[model samples]
Target chain A: MKNKKMAPIGVFDSGVGGLTVAREISRQLPYENIVYFGDTARVPYGSKSQNTIIRFSEQIIRFLRTKQVKAIVIACNTASALALDAVKDEFDLPIIGVVIPGARAAVEATTNGKVGVVGTEATVQSGMYTKVIQGMNPKIEVIEKACPLFVPLVEEGFKEHIVTREIIEYYLESMRNTDIDAMILGCTHYPLLRSKIREYMGDKIQIVNPAYETAMDLKRLLEEEEMANDETTEHHSEYSFYVSDAAEKFRKFANTVMPFDVPTTNVVNIEEY
Target chain B: MKNKKMAPIGVFDSGVGGLTVAREISRQLPYENIVYFGDTARVPYGSKSQNTIIRFSEQIIRFLRTKQVKAIVIACNTASALALDAVKDEFDLPIIGVVIPGARAAVEATTNGKVGVVGTEATVQSGMYTKVIQGMNPKIEVIEKACPLFVPLVEEGFKEHIVTREIIEYYLESMRNTDIDAMILGCTHYPLLRSKIREYMGDKIQIVNPAYETAMDLKRLLEEEEMANDETTEHHSEYSFYVSDAAEKFRKFANTVMPFDVPTTNVVNIEEY
Candidate 1:
């Protein structure tokens, strides 16, 4: 149990988008060490097929196992949608994905029982959010939208720009008409555009940030399984970052999204795993 | 020489974006067969480093060699910008990139000696177009802009949509004021947004589709090298398509961009090469 508590938690995404999840996890569980892997070389996994996403996720998981992670967080919504189930049992560690946690949050948050989901094309197409939300309560209506431009907009660093606002409005126009009391930001990158999305959706509608909820979920799971790191230790926890390409670029982007400084980042040839 | 004339010309882009280039090549060189590979599994080489792009391009070139291509066209602007020079000497065939042809055409078309170049972030950052254009004529001024959203807009099939127009105007607003007489669509996907871009820039600015110019350049090179396919063969030229993932998606996109029929597209595990 002591050794298990000291092991780092593995978190991964197709790219830096998953840093949002990592940030949230660190905020929620400050004592836990984290090892994050971003497959920057073959990013935007939302456009990829289920088989490819699964294969890539499997490879990433295999790589993370070498780091001796006590648990794994599939921080990417596309990978969570397509690859999570297939890989959940393959590894002995606790494997949690963003989909179920976000869905659970939406189910609990929705006052009108009409929930909206916004994510990449692949995630929306997977219908994982809809399945989980409906499974929780069949009466709840799920509206899934694929906002393909949102990710590009965020990557371009257009968070508060008028163009980003216009795009958000354009994507969420239909969802606004429906009485969706809660909206799940199904993509990790979507949280970066939170203000614009909230402005467009109005204050009445709850914005569900899966990263935050997933972090909370991870905290609960760790506590339940006695995997939480011992806070009694005087040593500070470390967070290590790895990407497939452009470590400098990833570091720059990481600084923008992450609250704490990322002192060093290593580039891993993800194909090797 | 006779056998060389029968061999297909190889063209490749990181993904289906190069279908725009393939369509132009087919239009210009009707008698020449084309073997096109879209590295769909690991695409958008724009964000990757020069070394990785060169490596991926080398792998693709090796695969194309197996198809007995007489010449090769690096249709991806990012690849042409970063990987072309590195791989040119590695192959015996006449290797062409969209940059030189596009730069040549821009130089020819720009009466005011001011040319605007738009492409992916990496291509624009590489300064390949600016260097090539300025090298031809030192007095010519080059303004390069990275329109990152354009590709996602086109992929979402928003070519003529108002959102696309707004985004284009937003991206090109600075270039429009610079008194440039021409703009090079440095990325193959940009050609699809030609009409909207033209409307934004007005009638005076010539929109250079590098794909078309590259095709013309290929035609000129084949003639110069005496490798033009003999039309007397009394056989129709065949165009074969290959992608690393989602053959059906690539086929659907090819149908939309390609004038002729693409009956089938094979999936290649590019890593194998």
Candidate 2:
């Protein structure tokens, strides 16, 4: 009787990094139907050009539109850095990107007024995080580093390995001497590397995951818009996964990050749309 | 007077990995023109879905066609893994991908009868290298590891850190006992991580670079087709770089990789095409 609410919320990433955000969304809003699109075919948009990213984002959005999604989350850092504005302009749906949430969290969490941001080359270069934080408080100093290898390490399921830890420390070593109170895991994949990042940066430095915060924001926004599904029916909400390249790899990764069983992951050719 | 050839040979990757291949081709055949498209906007296609990869590949090829490239080279492993066939069929241009040339080289280099192939998830999952090598000699044993982190490390410009060496050792530890005669750097970016990979594997193992081999193959193919550029005049050769995301990063990376100066690295919106 609630107008048979069935439209799914669409979320996209360059690859499995967005799974962190998707997992959080699923956990926090279990009643809502969700659809995830990972452009695994062209994952790690972090180092690409804005135009190519904008095009890829456009194709992905167009494909998601076909699935009848209510809103879109650009869970990829590189895409968010380079193409979020273009995507939002192209689509009338409520669009959310990790950068904004990350900037907000960094601004709120930094006690020493010195905050560090670490992500992919694209995210750091865009200066979006620095701009957003500075816009909030001009006195805050932001030190940014691009930890590009973290995404590949996480996707390869090497999150806890000593080698992965060593790599994280090496990448984070630069941020060590800086007097920063908080470090935003600007890229979603950075959250998976948090254990090592925490060990390297010490317990004092707060590691902010924009994905978790973005999910929380998503929950609040849905409630405010009266679009939150109220169906308390015992049926488990469905999550349909779509990927651009390899379905098997996506499934394997989903098993690693997802809390519940991913019943169906449909591989769709997004470029055709 | 002979007419000067001006159309660019379009080279594309999900990210900067393709630059290695492009560099080799540019060096060996400078007379031939080049135009590179890095989908840095969306990278790490290794763990993506096949359908989406095909879609992305199609879009890239379609975009390249607009530049009227005489030939198309898919420098991205994930795209080559899933979309090479579709790409070849959809486009009339002579298309070259990294898999076959690397496989051929691995087969030729292996003396112990066992060979190892290291690449991104998509390249390993496609099993194209294994099939190609085995097809050459069924007796050759092939071991494949998806070294996803390597791409990010290379992109982040962390090729020579002790931590990177540690990560490489961690990934290659399994290969120590395998007694592989040759190891193929299947991903173009892997070549940049050569020092680390070589340090772990040792001088005993012959490291094969697909990018170099692919360049040779391109040369051979062009000669066979009688399409090799005949421009022998000084300064007649030209190189143009295009990226989907940021122009500054592309210029910086071009400086690092290119043998000659890249006068201009432009950011072109491939999506609009």
Candidate 3:
């Protein structure tokens, strides 16, 4: 009901990995202010139950709303797959998730009509990517693998470690042998491990990073809804971050991922919400 | 407080890993009724901040206290390292943690003055094992390495996987060249990966599991305090399990580890506490 064109865009993930998505949004929409929430305390939502993920997503969305966000992006793929539909209908504002954008990208990139998706167990179990990709192109066949160890491996900062490569080999064994020409890095953290993934999956299998597609989707949506920042405003975008637990590690990680200095974010005891 | 001679002994960890300690208690003190709480929802307290771990530990302890537990064991090593000192004086009843017991075992097993301790970053950073082992014998040198990847790998159920072996090699590289005779698996989850560790570390280095020592310590405390379960009652020990997340996977895991059929446990939304 109220004008939200001037309000900040809300982006969130289970932890710091969503910074990849946040970074893309910042790069694409340089003038738009952003409010990012990382649920650092109870992170890696990929393995958690749908009910718990929904509850956490609701609490985070509610928290983001208080920041007067114009629109919200569920940057984490597991949350996007499991929690997005539940919250999108419940909330009033424009809400977009990484899954659909990722699915679209994978659908568009694949020439062999077969695609591989790597995500958490919850995301794979939901079968959302397969369904979404098939919906866009009925002829496309989707192969989904749950790489449960990838998130923890990435979060552990094992980007170039041999263990990571071994893990990549283990997780992508099925995907590697398949005829799928495109693989979706379905979890937000996977982007951070992109090089390792690219190295293992090889050059033939196009890796679809939903963060870039999700940013483009957001850009299009803002333009379609006439909600882009006013040209005359000369907006100097201010980025704010919030998390459920201690901010030290997340802040440090963000400083590496985000272009700007990671600000002193407040720790919200999200359970209270 | 009401006389609790027949009451259950409370035990808790970040997740189902504490079942090792609980299983140990059941084996050693067969007559004791044990109430165990595994914070499955917000697990892997190893990397969490001290304040957050303390708060979660307090909540679990309070939840356990409601069941009229006579003595409580901080089955999680990170919690023992970070939260025990903060909660021990605050609570009225006797509270014991895994660190001292594990340290004692490591010290006793070590033929050489140098002892190795492997655990989560928070646990290693706390320097609890070093301090406790040194407190017993000033001549002993304690080498602590934080294996941040172990808990997640264990939770992912990759006990004998190649990645697990590679990760084990990566984590134990520092300790492998050292003269330390005994390595303490300081975190509860480490015991699950014991076989792989033994293979990697070899038979020359004695491995210490805190679960067994912690149970022994509890047995000693019960007898010393004159609060052992009453012999005249003809007590049948009942084990009750409670976790914060979905119980199916945990229930399956428990059925495998636990001696008795783990009773249908309720999922408690622990944050409310």
| Number of the predicted model whose lDDT against the real structure is largest | 1
Off by over 4 Å in 2: A1-8, A49-93, A96-115, A134-143, A174-183, A205-207, A233-238, B1-15, B26-30, B35-37, B49-93, B96-99, B103-112, B210-216, B231-235, B266-273
Scanning candidate 3 chain A in windows of ten residues, the lowest lDDT window is A228-237
**Per-residue lDDT of A178-246 in model 1, one digit per residue for the tens?**
999999999998888888888888999999999988999999999999999986569698899998888
Q: Which segments of model 3 are wrong by more than 4 Å?
A: A1-3, A231-233, B1-3, B231-234
Q: Return the TM-score for chain B, candidate 3.
A: 0.96
User: lDDT for each of the candidates?
Assistant: 0.91, 0.80, 0.89
Q: Native-vs-model 2 lDDT?
A: 0.80
lDDT of 1 at A234: 93
**What TM-score does chain A reach in every model?**
0.97, 0.94, 0.97
True contacts kept of 2: 0.92
Which residue segments of model 1 deviate by more than 4 Å? Answer: none
> CAPRI band of model 3?
medium
User: lDDT of model 2 at residue A218?
Assistant: 87
As for candidate 3, its clashing pairs are none
Model 2 chain A: worst 10 consecutive residues (lDDT sum): A1-10
Tens digit per residue, CA lDDT, model 2, B23-75: 88987787888878887555567756566678767778888887778888888
Candidates ranked, most accurate by lDDT first: 1, 3, 2
